[model samples]
Structure formats: structure tokens, C-alpha cells
Target chain A: MTKMHMVSALNNALDIAMKADDKIVILGEDVGVDGGVFRVTENLQKNYGEQRVIDTPLAEAGIVGCSIGMSLNGLKPIPEIQFSGFSYQAFHHIKQHMARIRQRTNNTMSCPMVLRAPCSGGIRALEHHSESPESFFIHCQGIRVIMPAGPYDAKGLMLAAIKSEDPVIFLEPKKIYRSFKEDVPEEAYEIELDKANVRKQGTDLTMISWGAMTRLCEETIEDLEKENISVEHIDLRTLWPLDINTLSNSVNKTKKCIIVQEATKSCSLSSEISAQINERCVLNLEAPIQRVTSWDLPFPQFALENYFLPNKTRIKNAVKKVLEF
Target chain B: MAQEQIGQFGINHVSILDKEGNVDEKLASGFTKEQLSEMYYYMNLLRKFDEKLFNLQRSGKIGTYAQTKGQEASEIGSGLALSENDWFVPSFRELGVYLTRKVPKNLLVQAWNGDTRALGNPNHSHNLPISIPIGSQCIHATGIAWASQIKQEKDVTIVYFGEGATSEGDFHEAMNFAGVFNLPIVFFCQRNGWSISTPTTKETKSETIAQKAIAYGFKGIQVDGNDVLAVNKVTTQAIEKARSGDGPTLIESITYRMGDHTTSDDSMKYRTQEEINEWENKDPVLRFEKYITNNNILNEQEKTDIHNAIEREIQEAVEQGLSVEKPNPEQMFEDVFAQMPEMLKEQKEELLNEIIQMSEQNNNGGNQ
Candidate 1:
């Protein structure tokens, strides 16, 4: 095992998948020569040649729609949409065709493809560059949503996404692309989707989050431990097909919980988790469920990005509020 | 600015048979009597199917249907040009193409009857299900061809859409990709004059839809859509060019929609009777029939026999479609995913239980 970043881990996963399966192809804008804007797919074109790693014209809907076609023709395509914000251009294909093809054809055909998009904030870029669009995809029934917080999870989840028989929206948090590193295995492995990983088991308040926010929650919990505060932390790997059983079990033990997310609080995945907990673990609660999330306002530019994101302080404040109650 | 011609592009329109049952002597030898007769037979079959399905919709036997009354030559000619290995990507109104491809007539009826099972992606067929959304299948055609090219497969892909579909962004995207990648695909746009109520002139200001391919850096040809021979000739060349790795080509078949956009639509609301009557004079089936008579390919007795045979086939297909069992309601919950998610599983169970309880209540009412 070697220390790797999220981008490299994802690249390795693509390489491994492509090597094992000749049908697997990678397509997106600037994904071949430029190796993507973030260089996550660096040198893939040279290694896999132009046919396997294609640099398609700048068209999100076309990229996705064509990927669905490739899937129907028995090719496993992993199409990247540049950024999560730009995926809106492909929402029609995603919602209408990609998500509906299997059910539309009634089991005879499946779009066994993966749509990879960089999601969420922190690296303050231009408008429409750093917004979390996971909430939009999580609402889609036929598509699976997989978001990874670190290198290990990113590699494993990406492999699983590529192998899945149904279409998957694999959202890689751009915030943590190079923020840290972990000793990820070089071999191909799969981390189960719809399962939560308990980062730190505590009997007190349960803190649940995923993607970039999960890392922030881990840091917040680490600092809280210095102050003699024990926090049960859970990283939700897959947002949809949510591990509600693990969530409610933890919520019941802690008797209080705080859900954190980088996306806006309105109609976010946090609201769904909060509601589920409220219904399933209602009698076990000692206080109302807390949601530490960004305000409903648009993601600000770099100058005021700290104000819009759910930082450690915000998460800690929610934890203290839940603990005091 | 001086009136200097910097560059020029030409659009060729081909027609082998004229309206008065006269064929160009030079092209007449290229087709045999049997092939010409087969074209007429398929054309007659498709028209009969169209008339039958429209009547079925009127009697509430089927859901809303899209009629291909006047565009038969464009669809059938292009479909016939394709080999069995080539993929046929279609928009909703390619009934003539499907019939020409020999897709089960009963399956078409079942699909129009709102049965999803009829549309299941059949491994045995080279055709995809009819796409209701406009212009989406264009991209799929490019991708399918690209995959075939990557695998070094010789099979070509032919995608059919109408003139209005060219307005969609997906069309431009697919065209650009096919041009850049040199994919083995054919973009067959039937310029049928109307996209629902909108005219072709309203769709674009360009002289012809065929010219749109020039901007994408590929060859585009225009054909007389009313002339089945012309459509077959152009499509055969385009398909051959793709199979030989010559890249993509766009063939714009100029035709007219003699029927309404669909059963629910009324052409009289948008077009004049004069225009409809003028187009009727150039009817593809009638022109082909005239050719068969003038060329002495089939006598009156043989023509009558072929017509009777087509009508019998249509009747049998309709009966077969109606006789099939209605799909199970629970199937709606399946096929969404390889493995149903917990949420869908719960909903499916809930629905099944509800159906059981309702049946028990009906039984109690029967006892009373």
C-alpha cells in the first residue's frame, strides 16, 4: 500500500477497471489530453490510447446521452461531467433517459455506466463551480449516488460504481481531491454502498455526515475529544439507499444527533435523514435533532466561502447544543 | 465587399423513378424485378398497418399513435439499405422502418397498446425501442457506432429522425462527435415538412437540412423521399461508406407528412387541404405501384394477390397482439434496477398487499 490522494486513487480505480474489463471506456471534456481540469485523469489517454480514454466535445447532455448509448451497446462507459454544477445541463438525460432506461425497457436493457462529477465546495472557484448537487441526484430512484470522503473510500466506491449493473452518480468531493492522503491498497476492492463507516464510536451524540463534511466532522470530533467530549461519528458513504438502520441504531444509543452537510439545508439529504431519525428513534431522543448545514443562500465566492460552508466551528456548535440539551 | 466566391458546396437530390411511372433507363438496370417488387410489398404492408393502427386508436383499442402515411419511402428505403448487423436507431414515427427491418408486427401493436414488455431491449434485434423524445437517439447512434469502430466491427449504425429534431442541441452534439471521431454512422433526417404543427421553414432558415452536415465536416446528400429507389440508392452508398471506415454521412430525405402528427392531432388545424392534396399526388406507394405496372414487373392479378397477402398479415398481427396476456402489474416495480432498492421493494410489497386486500373485499361483496 502506498499513500495516495483522492484524485490518484480514483485514477487508479479507473485504470484497474479498464484493464480488467475491455468494454470499460472513459469519456468527457478534456479528459484525454488535458487529463481533466483537475488532472485526476492524468496520462490516461497516453496509457489507454485515444479510443479507450476519449476527450469528447464540450456537451454534458451529449456526453451523458451518448454514454447511455454506449452502455446499451455493451460498453461500460464512465463519463465525467467536468463539475457537479455543470451536470445540470445533463439533468434531462439523467432524469429522463439514464435513470429510466432500465425500467423503461423492463429488465431487457440496463445502462451499466458511471457518471463521475466533482461535487461540493471549499476550493472557492467561479460561480457554478463549487456547488453540491448530490441532493438532486439522491432523489432519483433508479440511479445510485456514491460520494467518497477520502482516498481509500474513493477508490473502493468508484470500483463498485463501475461494476454496478445500474447507472451510478459518483460524486467526488473536489474539496478533498488533494487536501489529504491515505494508505490505499493498490489491489482492486469494493466498499459496500449504502453502508455507514463509524469513524469514532461514542455513547454520546451521534454525528453523521458524508463527502467533504465527513472529514470536517472527523476533525471536529478529534478536537472535541481533547475537551473530554466523546462524540459518535459516522461517515455516510452512499447518500441514497441510506443506511437508515445504522443511523437509527446510533441515534437511539446516543439519544441525540446532529447531521452535517456542505449543501444548503433546504430539501437536502440532511432533511431526509433527520426526518427518518425523528420517526424511527423519536422516543429515544433527549433533544430535537440538529442539522449543521450551509445556509440556503447560493454558494459564495472564495472571499466569503467560509461563511457559506459548514466549518468545524459550526459542527462543534451543533454538537455542544445537542450535548447540552 | 467584392462578390468573390470563396468556397462552394453542392447538395445532390436523386430520383430513379418519376411520378408518371417512368424510370431513368440508366438506373433501371441496377435493380431487379424481385427487389422492386419487394419494395412495393413492404410499402403496401406499412400503409395497411398505419391505417389499421389509426383506426384502432379511433376505436379506443390502442393509445395515441403516430402515423407514417407519407414517409414510408424514406423509412423503408433507408431500412432496406442496412445489413442485418447494422443497428437501427429510431424516433417514435419510424413504423415503416421497423416493418422493413422485419420487427415482429405484433410487437409494434403491443407497444402502441401501452405494454412495456414489447419494448424490452431484444438481443436478437438490431433495432432499439422507439424513442418518444425528439433527437435523443441521434447521440445514441453516434455512440453505438463509435463503440463498433473501437472494437473494429464493420457494422454501421443508421439513426432516423425528422426535420424538427435537427433543432435540438443533441443533434448538433451527435453530429459534431460523429464528424470528429469518424464514427461509422448515418444520420437519416426525413424532412417531412412538419414537426407537429411547425413547418420546416420555421425550424431552420437553411436551404436544406442536408447542408447542416457540411458544417460538421462530412458529406450530406439530399434524396427524393417520395422515390423509394432514390432513398435506397443514397442510403446504400452512405452505409457502404461507413462500413469502409469512410466516417459518417447525413442523408436528408425530402418527404411530407400526409397524416396528422398523431392520432390525437389534427392536420387540418395547421395545414391547408390544398397542400395535403398536392402532396397526395406524389404518394410513395402509388408511384411505386405505377412503376410496377409500367415496368411489367407484376401484372394486375399478381398486384391484387400481393395486396391481399399484406392485408392478411396485418390482420393476423393485430389479432396476435390482442391475444397476448396483459402484463402483470407488479412488473412495474421490477427492472428499475438490477436489484430493487429497499424503498422500491417496500413500495412493491405495499402494492401487492393492497391488491390482495381489494380482491378479498370484492369476494365479500360477491358473497353478499
Candidate 2:
């Protein structure tokens, strides 16, 4: 009903979910009073009271671990990790326990919790603030990982994540928290977490990206068109339990493809997707799938952050390279 | 950001009831006599069931078993501390504790038999599934406690581990989170003096596990774990503190793992028989029996009947748990999702058909 930014959309989604379910709790560091470092949880405590909106001490493992317990105890917990890069501190819970909990307990129990982290680079923030790490979660089976490309996607994906019976990792694009605004509906709606959305249509090439990278892809197409390159764009909202049919159909049409992720270029999630594409559509390929990703280096300081991240120019160059091939 | 420690731990020990069945005026008993007797009876059941399982293992009826014999006081005492709605997150060896919480005896047997489907969740009671990974339960317990407080639920939580589990990173993280947030949790560490072959002397340089709480800004206490009365009293106080919203407490019950670490281990490889004998003399169950008998609380006939009753009950549980039908191979893949995806369904059908064909081929070969 109103034009909201990405963070505002998230706040609205959480507020709506919590208001509907008494068992739902919002937990994380500074999420209660300060409303998160980015204000995504702004005014939640004032509305729900301290019992529902909790500000936990800074420990990623504890946040995720406890959320699992809360979920088992009949509460729907929405946990915040402050930033995506810091999630490495909780790999034990995520890799060993988070997804395996239901399997560990013979499906007698499940971690019906959602972990919210601000992912992807471009905000020019500190080193760890803007890194994308969805691949680690994508590799996990029982758990679902997702990211939103815009305000509408953020609200819809968050609502879906909260409603899911299994544990979910909802990665928010931090750089775009306030960058764009859209008319998010007042009536609650859920965009399926496993379905991918095609942002634009073209036959020359299909550029795939998610999170903040989708915005850059849109910009890249704008410049690529100046040179008369009509490109297709696929925004993958959810990474795990992927909507492969969407990618296959799009790739089948375009033949040429480029995968742009803000995370590192090594054996990342994009590698898995590329392998899947090659296996499924090998005959239709016009060239090898190209990846425009960050280098395999620790996220550098903000001073050198620009070089560590992929920008519009990088995506355009990747498109040019794919087209030339 | 933190508080100061009063003194080093292991120097002070707590006890409430005496060997003569007299309650200490200085230490208050939290529960009535009826509740105390119920807890004592559960401990007796645990002891009898443990003996049965150990015998089963020795006779080749079951696989390796973890005997929770001498540590009954620690497990039962802590188990009784939780209210109906509270959670008891425990490690695998706390069989005595798990029994009190209704962890289906059959499921326990099924899990030990290597059938993953037999594993149950903490839903059996307000407790969690038995955690095999050391010290991992503490973080889960803290999480549940945090959620309870965050959701304004009246339920508190208790977590069980051993002295050796303190070394894990998750343990430190658990304490750090509980301390900072003032979470409602009771941390019970059964200091059984040894973790497998590693002795407490080399576990850590810290004087006492209880004192570790002081470093994290919480109250810590040491109790005579073999003294059933003391374990009950100390656990009650710590659990009550958590229930009242004062936050967590670290309780170190100084006991010994009177038997081998597990049925698969050999204590003789590392420890002396004389030490085991010394601990056997301090058996919590026998001492409590003596305390009650000496006071003329029960005649010899009554004691005999109690033992016979517990044996009969344990035998029934064993028979029932073993009698349950074995899980089907088809059901092994269930519960992963409410609705299995098409790929998993396809894979399951393929595996089942392959199994059928393989069986048919063997039958045909036998006929030929």
C-alpha cells in the first residue's frame, strides 16, 4: 500500500508475521532497541515489547543455535546475523546442526527458524559488511537459502521464508537497503522461495544474478543496449532447491549465458549452477558460461572495496566477452 | 561488562541431607517428601535399567552401552529440577536423566542399534533429543532458554554435559552468550573425573569447572555428586535461580565414572582397580539405602520388595522395547520433508525396485 525501501520492506514483513503469530519472535544483536544496525527491525520492540523483540549478545553461533531450540520449543524465531560475512563464525551450527537437525531427530523435530543476514557488496561499507556467502548454505540440503533483488522481492521472499516449515537463510542486499523504493502491497502475499523470476526478456544473451547484483545487471543491460546488445536477465531469488526449469528454458532460448555473483569466483555456488547448466543444456550452448565474481580474497577494507566487488562495467565486459566468444 | 570472582572453585562443597536421613537446617529442601521419593524411585529405575543394559551388552544381546551407574544422583537430581514445561537438553550418557524425561526406551535401543529412524526429538518431554556431540547441548539449551525469556514464556532450561566437554569452542560460546544476556539456564556438568582415557588432571588447568562461571559473570557451585541429597539440594537452588529470572548458574557435581567410560572401553588399560573400588564404596544408591534402613524407615522385607519391583519394571521395559517391530527400509527416507520432492521420490522408487530385483535374482540362482 505504500512505497518502502528494502529494509523497510523487511521490517514490514517481520511486523506482519509477528503480529499474526504469537509464537513468532525476532532475535539478534541490537535488533530490539536499536532496531538492527541498519534499522531493518526499527520500532519492533516498541510495538511488540521486549519479550518478542530480543537483542541478543553478539555471537552468531548462539543466535542460530538458540533459534533452532526456539523453533523446537514451538516458537518461530527470526534471527539476525548482523552481516553475511560473520556467518562463518556459525558454520558449525549451519553445516552440522542447522540443516541436519530434522534428520538428526528423525523429523521428529525441525529448526523452523529464519536467519536474516545482509549480503552482497556495493554499499562501500567495511570489509565484512558486504560479502555474499550464499554458496555455503546452498550446499546444504535440508536448509533453504534465498536473497531478494529489490523491495518487492525482499518482502515477498521474507514472508515466504518466515512461513516455511524448514529453516531458511534469508540474505538481504544491504547496499540497497535504502537505494530503491517500490509500492509493496498491504495485503500479505508470498513469492515461493524455490521459484526464480525473469526480470527482462531477450534472445541474444541471458544474464543471471541475485541480490544486489541484479540491480547491476539491470544497469549493464541499459549500457549494453546503447551498443545494440539486446540481453535477457534472470534474477534468481532463491539459490537452493533452485528453479532449474526457469534457468533451462531461458538458457535454451539465449544459448549464451553469464552468471554474475558478488561472492568469490572459486568453487562457489555459481560453479554448481554452471555445472548444472552445462549438463542440462550442453547442446544449446553458444559459448562457455562466464562468471563475473569477486576474487578469492578476504573482503578488503572499504578503501579497496571497489576493486573487490563486481560493478556494472564488469558485467558489461563479461557480456562482451561472452558475445565475442 | 563483567563481575568479579569471590574465590576459586572445588574448595567449597554443598550438601543438604545427611547420611542419617536428617535434613540440614542451613540448606532448604526445595521439594516435598513425595516429590523426593518420586525422584529417588526414578533413580532406582535408572540404576536397574542400567544394570540390565550392561548385562545385555556383556551377553551380546546389545551393542556397547554407556553405564550411568555411579552418576545416578547427578542425573536424577538435575532431572528433577525442571518444571513440566522446562527443557532438559542432555548429552548421550545421561540415561538416568533421559528415563525420568520419558525418552522412549525402545527409541533408545533402536538408536544404539544404528537405526537412524529410531532417534527421537526432545518432544518426548520438554527435553531435547540426546546430543552425541560433546558440549553442543549447552548452546542448544541456552538457545531454548533465550527463546523462553525472549518469548516471555515461564519455562526455564537445564543443560547437561561432562568435565571433558568444557574444552569445545561451543562451550565457551555458550557461556559467553548466557552470561551477556542473563539467560534463564541451569548448566549441570557431571565431573566424572575422566573423559574416555583422558583424566581430569589433563582436561584443563582450571581449578574447577564451576569456577568457569565466575569468569563469565554468573554464580557457580560445587556439589558432592555421589551424595544424592547434596546433588538434589544444589541443583534445586541453581534451577530455582534460573526460574526466578536471576539468570544462569554453573553447577559442577564432583563425581567419578565408577565403571568404564562405555561398554566398548576398558578402564583397566588406564586406571587402577583400587581407585574403582574406592568409588564403589561411595555408591550413591547403596548409601541412600543404608541411610533409610538405619533410620528404621523401611524393613528388610520392604527393601527386598523395592528391588524386586524395580527389576520387574526394567524387565518389562526391555521386553517391550525389544518387541517393537523393526523399521522398514522404505520408511528410512521419510520425515526429511513433509512432502518429498519428485527427485527424492524417483530415487526412492529406483532404490526399492533395485532391492526387489536383487532379491529375486538371488532366489532364482538358489532355485537353479
Candidate 3:
């Protein structure tokens, strides 16, 4: 095992996958020479050559639409959007073609490609560079949505997404891209998609989150444990095709739940999970389900980003509210 | 500082046959009798099939249908220029292209009937499904060609769209990518006079859609879309150039819609009878028929035989399409993912149980 950050781990996964499969290609703006804006694909072009690692023009829709075409022609292309905010430019292609090609063609043609984008805030970057838009992709059908919290799962989940037969929206938490390091496997490995990872187990309250928010939840749970409050922390690796079984089991055992997300609360994945928990384990709940998410307002500038994002204080307050209820 | 001109570019127009069936002998030469006859046959077949589909929509047998009444030559002519190894990416309203590519006639019928099975097996067909969203397929074609270029393959990709599609960002992006990569692709735009109610003048202020390619650093030409020979000749040259690594070409085929955009539209609301009459006089099928007769490629008896055969073939396809069994509702849940997730599986089970209970309730009510 090698100690690596999320960026290197993702780059290693792409390298291993490309070396193994000639049909696997990587394409996006600055992906070829510069290795992506976040350097998640560093030196991929040098290793795989320009043919496999392409530097596309500055057009988001073109990158995605071309990836769909490449997928149709027996190539597994991974196209990266510079940031999650810019993905809206390609939303039409994502919603219309990439997500529906298989169902529209009745399984005759399947789009087996992965769209990678750095998402969530905390980097103090420019505007439109740090927005969390996972909810938009989760609402789309015929596509898998995934976000890995750390280096270990980043490598594993990205490999799995590359191998998936269906289109996958792989959202990387750019905030923690290089913030921390973890011991990740050197060789190829795959984490099963559509499953949640149980980070810690307890019985008092269930703490559920994904992506960068999961790291904050971890800190919150640790602090809560010191105060004699046992919390079961779950990191949702795959957002869609959600592992509701794990969530329901945890909520049932704990008899309480609090969901956190970096994205806004309205019509979000947190809302969906909250509704699901109520439907499945409502009778077992000792308290009302709580949600700690960013406000419905647009993601604010860097000066107020910390205030906008859900922090340890907000999460701890929500935990207290659920426990008191 | 002295004034200087950086670049100079010019657009060329190609027309091998006129409305009166008079051919430019030099340009129309070298087409074998079999090839000429096949072109005539497909154009006529497309026209007849289009009429039948229009009738089907009127009789409520199918949904709203787009009629390829007068632009048959533009679609079939370019379609015929493609080799079996090449890819044919189509926008909607390319039924003639599908027919020329030899897509099963019943599959075409099934598509208009709102069935997913109409998208023929991808493993066996090089033609893509008709993209409903305007101009979206251009980037897809560019990518396919890019893939071929990467793999060092000789196959080419040809994408078809209308004049209005040129205004879309995807179209320009695709052209730019094709030019930059020197990918083997053909952008075949049929200037079919109108984009629904909007005319070409409102679509673009440019003198001709063909010149749009020059801005992207490639060659572009305008062709007489009503002249089957000209479209075929121009497309053949472009295909050859692409296969030989000369890069992409944009051919704007000048044609007319000759009918409403689809069954839901009424051209009379926006166009004049005189204009329709003018286009009717330049009908692609009649023009092609006249050319083939003048050149002795097909006699009157052979024309009659081909017409009857196409009529019977279209009728058989319609019957076959109607007779096919409806897809099971469970199929809706199957293709969304290769392996159905637990949530989808549970939902499918719930739907199935609901259906069973509804049928049981009806039976019980009948007994009561």
C-alpha cells in the first residue's frame, strides 16, 4: 500500500485502467498536458500518449457529447468537467443522451462512460468552481452517481466506475483532494457501487453524509462520542441506487438519524434520504429525522463560504436537536 | 502601418442536373446503369414510404410523422456515398437515409409507432438511431470520427442535419473539433428551406450555409439537393477525401421541405401555394426519373416494376410492424442498467404485483 491523497489515488486508478484496457481513454480540457485543473489526471498523457489522453477544446457540452459518441463506438471514455458548476452547460447532453441512450435504444446501445468533476466547496477558489451539484445528477435515471470520501475509496470506486456497464457520474470532493492522505492499494481494485460504507458503528444516533461532508461528520461523531452520545456514522459512497438497506438498518438500530450534505436542502439527495428513512424506519424512530445541509441560496463567495457550508457546529447542533426530540 | 489582407476564401456550388432533367454531361458521367437505377429506386421508395407514413398518421395508426417529401435526393444521395464500414449519424427527418442504408423497413415503421425496438441492433448496424434533439448528433459524429482517427482506422463518419441546426453551438463546436483533429467526417446539411415555421433567412444571416465550414478551417460547398446526381457526386468526393486523410468537409444540400415539418404542422399557415407549386415542379423523384429515362438507365416497364415492388414491400413492412407484439411493461425497468439495482427490482416487483391484483379484482367483480 502507498500513502497517497485523493488526487494521486484517482490518477493511479486511471493509469492502471488505461494500461490494462486499450479502449479506455481520458479526455477533457487541460487533461492531456496539464493533467486536469486539479491535477487528478497528472502525467496521464505522458504515460498513455495523446491518443488515449486527449486535451479537448473548452466546450463542456462537446466534451460530454463526444464522450457519448466514443462510448457508442466501443471506447470507454472518461470525460472530466473542470468544475461541478460548469457541468450545467452539458446538462442537456447528460440528461438527454448519456443517461437515456441505453433505455432509449432498449439496450441496443449502452453508454459505458464516466464523467468526472471536482465538486463541493472549501477550496476558497473563484466563483463557479466550488459548487456541489450532485443532486441534479442523482435525479437523472439510467446513470450511477458516486462520490468517494478519501484516497482509499477514491481509487477503488473510480476503478469500479470505469468498469461499470452503465454511465457513471463520478463527483470528486475537490476540497479534500489533497487535504489528507491515506494508505491506498497499489494494484487494481474495485469497490462495489450502490453500497454505503460504515465508517463507525454505534447505537444512539445515525449520522449519514457523503463526499467531503463525511469527513466533517467523522469529526463531529468523534466529538459527540466524548460527550457519551454514541453515533453510527455512514458514508454513502454511491449516491443513486442508494443502499437504503444499510440506512434503514442503521436508523432502526439507532432509533434516530441525521442526514448531512454539501448541496442545498431543496429537492436534494438529503431530502430523498430523509423521506426514505421516514418511510422505512419511521415507526422505530425515537426522534424526528433531521437534515443538516447548506441553505437553498446559491453557494456564496469565498469570504462567506465557511458560513454557507455545513460545519461541525451546525452538525453538532442538529445532533442535539434530534436527541432532544 | 500598411493595410494587409490575411486570408481569402470562396465557396463553390455544384449542380449536375437541373429541374428540367438536363444533365451537365461531363459532371454526370461514369455512373453505372446499376448504380443509377438503384439511386432512382431508393428515392422513389422513400417518397412512397413517406406518403404511406403520412397516411398512417392521419388514420391514427402511428404518432406524428415527419415527411421527407422533396428532400429524398439529399438524404439518399449522400447515404449512397457511404461505404458499409462508415458510420451514418442522423438527425430526425432522415427516413430516406435510413432506407438507403438498408435499415429494415419494419424497424422504421416501429420507430414511428413509438417502440424502442426500432433502434436496430447496434452491433450489426453502423447507422445511429435518429436523434430527436436538433443538432445534438453533430458532436457525436465528431467523436466517432475521433475514435477512428485514434485507432488508425480508415472508416469515415457522416452526420446529417438541417439548415437551422447550423445555428446551434454543438454544430460549430463539432466543426471546430473536426477541423482541429482533422477527423474523417462529413457534415451534410440539407437546406430544406424551413425549420418548421421559421425560414432560412431567420436561421442565419450568412449568404449560404456552406461557407460556415471555412470559418472552421475546412472546405465547404453548396450542392443542388434536388439533383440526386450532384449530391451523390459531391458526397462521393468528400468521402474519398476523408478516407484519404484530407479531413472533414461540409456540404450544404439546397432542397425544399415540400410539405409540413411533421403531421402536427400546417405549412399553409406560413408558406404560399405558389412557392409549393414551384418546388413541386422541381421534385427530386420526378427529376431523377426523367434523368434515368433520358440516359436509358431504366425503361418505363422497369420503372413500373420497381414502383409496384416498393409498394408491396412498404405494405408488408407496415403489416409486420402492426402485427408485432407490444413490449412488456417490465421491460421498462430492465434496460435502465445492465444489472437492476435492488431499488429498481423492488419497484418492478411492486408494479407486477399491482398488475396482478388489478386483474384479480376485475375477475372477482365479473363473478359478482
Give me the candidate number with maximum DockQ: 3
Any runs in candidate 3 off by more than 4 Å, and if so which? B361-368
Q: Please rank every candidate by TM-score, starting with the best.
A: 3, 1, 2
Candidate 3 residue-wise lDDT, A1-325, digit = tens: 9999999999999999999999999999999899898899899999989999999889999999899888888889999999989999899899999988888888888889999999989989889888899889878888899999999999999999999999999999898899999999899999999999999999889999999999999888888889999999999999998999999999999999999999999899999999999999989998888999999998888999999999999999999998898
User: Model 1: per-residue lDDT, tens digit, B1-368?
Assistant: 67988789988878888877788888767888788888989989988899999999999999999999998888888888989889999999999988877788998899999999988747544678888889988998888898899889898999999999999998999999999999999999999999999999999999989999999999999999999998998999999999999999999999999999999898898899999999999999899889888778999998899999998999999999978999998898888888877777888999999889889989889642
Q: Write the per-residue lDDT of candidate 3 for residues B71-150, one digit (tens) a residue.
A: 98998899899998899999999999888888889888989999987875565557889898999999999989988888
lDDT for A170 (candidate 1): 92
Residue-by-residue lDDT tens digits, candidate 2, A95-180: 77778877767777788888999887777786677778888887777778898999999999999888888888999888889998
Docking class of 3: medium
Winner of 1 and 3 under DockQ: 3
TM-score of each: 0.97, 0.89, 0.98
Kindly list the per-residue Cα lDDT of model 2 for residues B1-368, writing each as its tens digit. Answer: 89999566344678765544455655633455566566657778888888888888898767778888899888887777667677888887888777777777766666666666667654564767678778877888888888788667778888889999999877887898899889899889999989999998898998888888888889889998877778877777887888889999999998789878889899999999998898887777777666566555566786677778788777777787667776777765675555565446766898899888889989889642
Cα displacement (angstroms), candidate 2, residue B118, comes to 3.6
**Model 3, residue pairs in steric clash:** none
Rate residue A125 of model 1 by lDDT: 86
**Regions more than 4 Å wrong, model 1:** B1-5, B121-125, B365-368
